[model samples]
Target chain A: MDRINVCIIGSGNWATTIARNVGRNVANSQHMEPIVYMYVYEEIVDGRKLTEIINTTHINVKYMPDFVLPTNIVAVDDVVKTARDADILIFAIPPTFVNSCCKTLLGKVKPTAHAVSLIKGFERGDDGQIVLISQIIMRQLKIPCSVLVGCNLAHEIANDNFVEGTIGCRDQKYFRLLQDIFKSATFRVVVTDDADCVEICSTLRNVIAFGAGCADGMELNENTKAGIIRRGFLETLQFVDVFYPGCRMATFFEACGISDLVTSCYANRNRKLAEAFVKTGQPLSELEHILIPGHEPLGPVTAELVHIMLEKKGLADKFPLFTVIYKICVGDQPLTRLVETLRFAREDM
Target chain B: MDRINVCIIGSGNWATTIARNVGRNVANSQHMEPIVYMYVYEEIVDGRKLTEIINTTHINVKYMPDFVLPTNIVAVDDVVKTARDADILIFAIPPTFVNSCCKTLLGKVKPTAHAVSLIKGFERGDDGQIVLISQIIMRQLKIPCSVLVGCNLAHEIANDNFVEGTIGCRDQKYFRLLQDIFKSATFRVVVTDDADCVEICSTLRNVIAFGAGCADGMELNENTKAGIIRRGFLETLQFVDVFYPGCRMATFFEACGISDLVTSCYANRNRKLAEAFVKTGQPLSELEHILIPGHEPLGPVTAELVHIMLEKKGLADKFPLFTVIYKICVGDQPLTRLVETLRFAREDM
Candidate 1:
């Protein structure tokens, strides 16, 4: 393999991480250094600020400090000139801005680039669709590019730390090529061909994160967290299985599925939203007003998605915990009272 | 299943739990009304103390108050004379005095009694002899009996809270017989014929508890603790697999193996040993000498046993962690340095 030039857009945490990990694989293959170009939006494009943020990250502090952008990293005031001839393009912007950003990039479309998405939230609009970032990219560019998404923790990746994640794309050659470019001593890359399962898993996990945040904000320990997370995965798999019968439910033994849910919900910023509710004794509406780009919406959206799916498929009886969380997040019910009622529901299971 | 009369020998935290869980079943079972007796060494034990000790103990406080010793319970002074014959007998005595205590009951031992043990320690002689509690019992009684042991927490059992435990015996009939008697809504009982695996798992766990406590005393968190526990399991299982081959390696996945190691090492009295060492700056040897009945020695003896077995078989390479721990504990080495070296050693594995 010759030198692989990797381009990352929206130079945020996850974006910085993929660049760092891919960049460190310089010596992994013969006669090659994966040269990574991070395109920072001019507003936050100060190279020093980017370096500070990247350096402050544990992943950078530990594994990929060398991959930190140089003082000469390109500050793109012009979007067209920024993505002129990218090879491996990535959309690492937040979901809300991704559609508009993709439109901005469509005019300067790098026709032959293979794209990967790192954005997390679902795009909400008039129809209120749970559109994935990859789908949005395809809609804008009129190109079928592969999607790569999984439980890639920013702190772990930034720390040059490795975590298990699935790199799923329909194109085997594209998947292997990406895997080889990203693989390092600590970083692990798992390949899969199921795009639907991968997308559903990536998007739906945030909903479970809402449930996990609720559990953690409540100070329920690992046992209760385990129960909640296990139920969430069951619901997730059940939903995904309807769309893709070949999807395998994660055995609780493999901490990846539930562990990922717990980390996103409790240890990360999403959990802080639920913690705010418990601490302030306020409701979700109040929270949404206060938290600009509030993490609370994932809860209601996930509850709605799971509820609509369960109701449509008539599988409500299978996941009692999901049903209760769905009711609590989206219904007219008081959470305190619902918690009291659902406490007994888990006793039988 | 018939309601079986169950009796525990100690008034310690664990003994009371066995009584409470079994007693509830006896009360509800149509076959027989259960009788639970806490053989308190102290007369008129304070219920408040018991409650404080067992925060949310499951058996009704009203049913068995501190002042009111149930008819089923006979004080130690009156146990030999007034105690009614029981179908199932549980010896929950402290392992330290088990031999002497069992010697007293030798003549009173019932032929049909199904005995179980909840102790997790080994006895060592001054000249360097090690004996397991069950081995002592077999030698004293001149008859074989079944035993149940594993990673069981007392507080949960006291409140009739659900937990997973292992039941092991040479005879499957005896193991299942004891299993049926203790099986209740809150208790999960898995019966196995491999006593050696159960013994190795239960004992080796305490040694890792010391390791965990040492880490916690030094201010480590989940990631570090988890790594030590995982490696420690491999170390313990190396010896266990040698002694008991048929026992599934996945048995380490049970609450007794990993979860118990985590809690006992980081959160319990076993871990508290590290606090004394760090706070007082007391030498471990001096501290161990002072706290003669230290539960700390439980794993040490098992460590020695493992070391001896490995040395004899020349299979020391199979378990590097065990070898390091055993050498550190017995040698005139600096405790802190030894612990630091172990943590570093684990990264390579």
Candidate 2:
């Protein structure tokens, strides 16, 4: 078997985690049949002083180091030069930089290379389509690609903890290859050919995380949280089925969707930031700057998602959690009212 | 439509709450409909004190109240002498006493009466079946019936708050009749034709609530509690399907299952008591003897259910949360472990 060479673009937390996990697997193999190369594109921040205020993560070149990084890497610079020679190229850049980054890396990367995406958000428009990070790259580059996403990334890399996620690709070979390459004791992965399902699951997983964060910020009990996750599941299902059908509903039997939704809502830093902002009545812009700049703004994406459900889909009555989350995000409602609505809806359900 | 007459049997806190809520609805109604008749079965408890409890509850009874002496209320008692004309007969007695209570109520109440059960637990043995309170009555008396259950009665009535719940029957006419009878803005009730689902939802709601008590006993988090409720949903779907395959799985989509589970796990007093015992590291037997005898002993039922799931079903590997919750109940694991397992299983999902 030709060793699969997996190259990741961006030195973000997600990018670093996948590289470390995959690289370690290849290095530890007794026979070393297939060599994996991880290319990290670290942007030059003035004086390397960005870490002074926020904090910088160390990437482990040792591959599976006891402390930081966790991967053997042949790190590279500049998107065009590094991605030119790779079998599989993964884009883990923040959604905000997706368009510009795609423009720079498109033709330089292998034309037939499997393009994998991990970005999540909805591009603003009259018809507002949910855009996968891979789709954004492929559209700009004029190439076809697949996506791999779900719940395991930052915590897995930063905390050296075990986490499970899903891989999605329309191509069977790429899906299987990615699944086999990434599967490990600590990092379990499931492969699916349902791009739409994977796309929706990946996208809403973050959106719902914001809702879960609101639930957490309120210190609501399990019953309320369970209802929130379930309702979130239904909301995603409704939106996906309305906009893009035939995607296998990935969460019908799986724990990743519901559990991940809960985790994101409660523990995810991005969501926690949003929740804190809402709780303290901070300005939306201040909170927006803190969260992962998903597409335009995290709060608006969430608000618009809820708005679409109510206005377009007419599902506001069915999913009070979605509406509550929207109201909380926009500061239109208090947490108690959200809880009351949820309770009222629960009574009605 | 004819006003439905409701007769409640048993005088525990649960039974009293149901009676009180129903009484409140009747008192506040524009017309005298769904008139509630509360019955206290005291053949087991000494007669005098049971009377005292009944009298105390009567202090605020806005509706007409009836008290039948213990001996005369037996099956041998004239069928019409006590509840000859009642419409709905509620079995609110403890699970252990339900079988005998059914024998006593059999033929004594109206043959056409609709049955509403409030008990929560299963009859353990070769059958290993959830002997629903109504089922025991129907089986013993060979009568057809419906059931109403889900939320904890104390939370609904004593707390003077709305607790989400469901009413289930095989017939639509009976379902609607019960719906109209219990319809209140505050006492929200969702109706379904899923007898098996409601029975399973109600019983498992208690079992999980008991588990929640265990979680709270040790001071677990929203994450751990969320995990338990999620697992509770899975275990519920599993157990209900195993026992009653034809039941509509959509019932899991209702508040009675998900929302009810949350309240049972987070807000119920029984779980609070169990949490206290767990925090103090008291023996389960001692705990049970002190606080569990009068009611259905749902706390112990939850513990036993956890044992069955872990030791007998061998589902710990697949549903790791169950394993962690099992340890929590048995004192072998910390509540933190339960939270960790929940967080991981979710990440894994």
DockQ of every predicted complex: 0.10, 0.23
Which tens-of-lDDT digit does each residue in B199-305 have in candidate 2?
Answer: 76776666566666766665544444544666667777766765577887568767667556655666665676668677777766676667655454565565556
User: What level of docking quality does candidate 1 show?
Assistant: incorrect
Encode model 1's per-residue lDDT on A1-349: one tens digit a residue.
3455556676665666666556555445553433445566543224445434543442333223445543323334445555656666766766777777778878586577677776666665344345666777888876655555544466555554334455656677786777776655445555666665666676666666666577666664443343344456556666676745776543222223433454454455545565666566677677766863523356667667666666767776666666766676654454453333323333222
Which docking class does model 2 fall in?
acceptable
Residue-by-residue lDDT tens digits, candidate 1, B192-268: 66665676677777767666666566664333344455557566666666766777644554445544554455445
Clashing pairs in 1: A58-A159, A59-A158, A59-A159, A59-A160, A60-A158, B26-B34, B57-B159, B58-B158, B58-B159, B58-B160
**Model 1: residues >4 Å from true position, as ranges?**
A17-34, A42-87, A95-266, A275-280, A288-314, A331-349, B1-3, B37-72, B77-84, B96-108, B121-153, B156-266, B269-294, B297-349
i-RMS, every candidate? Answer: 6.4, 5.3
DockQ value of candidate 2:
0.23
Root-mean-square deviation of Cα positions for candidate 1 versus the true structure, in angstroms: 7.4
